[model samples]
Target: MKASRWARAAALLVLVGFTASCGLPRVGPNKREIYSGSVQREGDAFIVSVNDRVTRATAVVPALGFSAAFRNAGIVGSDTIRPGDTLGLTIYENVDDGLLAGQGLNATMLEEVQVDGAGFIFVPYAGRIRAAGNTPEAIRRLITERLADQTPDPQVMVRRVAGDGATVTVTGAVTQQGVFAIERPTRTLSAMLARAGGVAVEPETARVKVIRNGHTGEVWFEELFEDPQADIALRGGDRVLVEADTRSFTALGATGNQTRVRFETQTISAIEAIAQVGGLSPTTGDPTGVFIFRNEPEEIAKQVLGRTDLIGAQRLVYVLDLTEPNGLFLARDFVIRDGDTVYVTEAPFAQWSKALSAVSGTLGLASSLASIADNLNNN
Candidate 1:
């Protein structure tokens, strides 16, 4: 009985040490710069920002009245076609009844046309067709005239065999990967993604960028998701890349989960931010260390705390304490801006438990190994 009790006690001691190691307080040492501030809490909820700064303008305006920004931003132009672009065409005078023979298009090589990388498609009987700068109607008329000499009543139908031009590239978190061909006008970015088997990972933020004519343009993905007017249409030969969320906000220090969240809008609330992080850990989290680091000094915390000494009127640190129950109400109302960080500190006991647990695990593991070795030797 005594030996069994001793063995059990030893095992418990080892486990206690292991538990302590896992309990250590985590204070991330790196001081990352961020933009954080307090926003007044109101019962009403509203959208953060309506205007997008990066996507609103383009670089140049063509004679066609399309803005320069539209071109620089990759929003317009035939050379700027992306995957899932639709090209429509109506043939003019040359209708080919002989080739059809009351059935369909003849199996002759003359019916085949090759689309090139430069946004040009070649019709066998028509020779080199200039499609880069021309609209679908223009391409059809050009084809109709070229075949007028050889075949009477030559009717030409023009549409994209795949994409507006030739190929489209998908970058970032997609599954099947790389640039691919668009074979039909009914294809879409969403459809292509579905064909590609969808995105590899579901990020906190989701967005798609359209690159064309060597320019980067952003699609209003949220608008596209909501079927709004702000959503831009895609073109052939355009590269569509769906990447992980570009913006992220980090929550460090004392929280249930120290994780980063994607930023969708310009403004977020402290309560919302806390909710994203899974809230406070019951045993270790301290209400006092809840802070939003900014360019300002510690004195910033004083205003939030309604106290004057701790923040010291310095211009470097901004801290906020949620010790008071009313602080929760204030925090719920406070607005957290983009690129903000929310941190909470662990209690002293929690920190000590973590440190002791670490030391205990190392010692316990060593002791367990030593006991096993002794038993083996005895056997």
Candidate 2:
């Protein structure tokens, strides 16, 4: 009788597996092209509207394509220059007066200068000079020429009042929001960010925005940070912005990919979310029980009814029956909303597997107890 019982249980397990086969095809969700032409258009509009090219590119472009755009536009994602940058100057021929006082040409005293937004520095004698873009060596030459025409053996010294000129401002998701003074003369956007602080979060999907003369442009954080040769270089009036990581969701259990996913609200679809998580774990998943649990259930129903109200309550807790083969296409067309949790149910076979495992575990424990009791009796 015991043998017969075991046989029957084994047959039941097999039947469970067989019946599940008819429900829905078990496979990883199809790879989705999350970023499409429409997304590109919308992102472009955002960039234009913000008047900041950096904002549009980071938030709008397909994550992959954004990198290319950033490279082309010369936006740096991670570099920053802040207050307290160091500037040094050496004076030739005029060291006799002991250096001009306060970045001046006065004999005997030279003083460190302060820079302003217009890139100009006020000197004791020469007044304000545009010093933002000029290289150190170049500035030195200019001083030499200016002094030669004034006093005999006029020695002039040039140095950064502070190293602020080589730096830039980086806000958003960087380690810190501040100015990062560039160390080397040939400072790229990437280098500036490293100096200020690296990114504060994951680089993937992180948006990199740059503001130039109030015009905003965007790119991927990685492209601007990791790829220096191609993506990040600073131009005058360039500002690098890195946005913080946005909240996303995960699709598991019966879904195509059993992986965690990140997406903007209303940007992903039920189908696309499934494919991103590496599909459901086959041994423990049910393909047909694909459901999305949203806080706004009504929002989902509105979509089914083709109503203009894209978000409602019922839509939040709606379920998708992928048992029908054609549902695959429909899933692709559906847009996923933020905070929507996708769940795939367990098939009968999976349930049976769980039951059998539980039974086996229980029996093993019992047997171990029996053996211990028998040994005690013998003793």
- Per-residue lDDT tens digits of candidate 2, residues 250-355? 6756544555577733256666677777665677666655666544344334434345644334322344555566667656655565555677666656655655
TM-score of 1: 0.47
TM-score of each: 0.47, 0.47
Please report how far candidate 1 places residue 322 from its true position, in Å.
3.0
The weakest ten consecutive residues by lDDT in model 2 span: 43-52
lDDT of 1 by residue, 1-379 (tens): 9999999888866776666556444665322212222132322211121112211211111111123453333334433333333444434333435432333543232232444556566565577777665655677778778877867766666664444345566777778776555544324556566556667755334566767678665543343445433344445566777775555668987787888887654346666787788887788777655665433224443443344566333222234456765666656656564456777766657656765667667788999999999999999
Poorly placed runs, candidate 2 (over 4 Å): 1-88, 94-112, 115-146, 149-151, 155-167, 171-203, 209-219, 222-239, 252-278, 281-284, 295-304, 308-314, 321-323, 327-337, 349-379
